[model samples]
Target: MPITTEPHVAAKPALTTTVAREYVHRAALSEVLLTGWNKTGRDAFKVTAQWPRSHSFYVSEHGMHDPLLLCETVRQASTLLAHVGYHVPLGNQLSWSRVQFAVNPYALRTEGTPADIQLHVTCSDIRHHRGMPVTMSMHMEAVRRDCLLAVASVRFGSHSPAVYQRLRAGKGDVNEVFAQAPQPPEPVSRSTVGRLRKQDIVLAPTPDRLRWQLRVDTSHPVLFDHALDHVPGMLMLEAIRQAGHAIEPARGGAVMPTSMDVSFNRYVEFDEPCWIEAEPVETAAPSSDGRRTIRVAALQSGLCAVNATAELTDTVSL
Candidate 1:
């Protein structure tokens, strides 16, 4: 895929430490992007994050940060605010119901230093259970040196341990399901998915060009940072993004996912074969710059696991 490079900006000094890994549910501090945050008003805050110039994943051509990186950053910030700002119990599990992100291609740039980020976040549609917030929505703007990089939002719900346990109704539990999952099928060519590393490619070839078998790699360091009973929602988001790339005829990595609006309908199981399918969003108006749009769906057991509309652009919009 072709990517436009922006003028490099010098790094400015900022917070030096990341938040606790537990707050963001990350097993490694190396994966944490949030640096600090402070409450500004009721259900509002100012948060800071930093993106590394070089990461194992989350980068496109010319070192421009990938949009998925921003997605992950917002995901982390959401959990952090829930745990510390909202006082949700540490043991409670948070899951996103909806997630959307849009980026300006010009703002995805880097020199030799990390990108220092500032986000203004506000929460809404809060619903409480037992005097604690059980569900909420967050909207945030990601800025770098006064430049608007991206804007994103997430609607998520938090469930207590007991409630979460009851929600699991599959074969055995998550661990057993994960253990029984078949070996990951061979992935398509790294170049086909616009990935430099083979392990990062998440699609397996199928006879039908518009569809692919979802390749689940539970051992992947970043996506599967910790074990769970089901496939992580982020992984499904990624599968759709890749599906958009492959669904385009004659466009492999050429069709790159720049922005995505995803609604996770159900948990994607580990032991079953999940299919990623894509279709063009003909009703949706195209961007002035001629960006292609596609709706991708994850199908497991003939049911939609996720429904997402992804905007594709030739230039890097991460």
Candidate 2:
């Protein structure tokens, strides 16, 4: 009889603390939403965090947590996966392709009591070419005391720092470009933006019902405590939410976002006139609870910068 040999498979290396340290930064604990994390599997992690009451980012004068904070939470959780076993390179610039986040409007408040937030994250849809990871996707669920607060789906790509630096160099110094004070638009009716206060309204209506202008006041204590070279991504997300509120009136007189899918095609610079346009996407009839979807786009220099689709529901008084 002829002898046959089988090929042997090599086992994956176990995760080590040293390797984790290279990707996880301690500074994020104070600056970002990350508080701590624990490895649960080869591609899964459990993250813990608490919303800050007075952080320069994401805090509102009303003491309510901004919906944008959920996006950051999802970003941090995805980064945590890089430490355990994902092939994320150190010092790489993380970019998003698509992000979808959904929240339970009734459980959106996070001001008075310190809510213990737990995030369960799983990394999947990893695509590699030439033995290098080109893209990956993550799914996360945020909970407080067993109550589902939010869920998110995010797709990310890693870019070399050299490429990012070279691209940004063409634009003026980042600090100088973003240092301009926010210019508030002429006062508009509160109902125009579905906001109760003038300070909270971020959109200025135009003659066209579907078109509005971006009104960013960098001087606002909560929205612009720090300066930058461009409009922050959070502001773009808020603009979409506010635009949805303006276009789609909630059946019960309160517009609460229940779901959102957003994609950023480019950055919106501060010096340019950014226009926001919103329209209703025909979908199945509104649910019994009055949930409906709106499509919004942020355009700069006649180019689309950010596109979003959001679902809103009436506020449920607790």
Candidate 2 structure, TM-score to reference: 0.75
Cα lDDT of model 2 by residue, 1-318, tens digit: 998988888998964222232343323324555667777887787888766655554544333455667776676667666534565667666667788999875566655665567889887988875665668988889997898989998897776667667767766665676675457786447776566667767788789988899988676554553555567666787788788877866554556667889998987877788999999888766566777789999999999999989987655322
Model 2 CA deviation exceeding 4 Å by range? 1-32, 52-67, 79-92, 106-112, 127-134, 180-184, 196-199, 220-225, 249-253, 316-318
Computed on alpha carbons, the lDDT of every model, listed in order, comes to 0.84, 0.71
User: lDDT tens string, model 1, 149-184?
Assistant: 999999999999888888874456666777777789
Residue 187 CA displacement from its true place in model 2, Å: 5.4
lDDT, model 1, position 315: 59
Candidate 1 Cα outliers beyond 4 Å, as residue runs: 1-15, 170-173, 249-255, 283-290, 316-318
- Each model's RMSD to truth, in Å? 9.4, 10.3
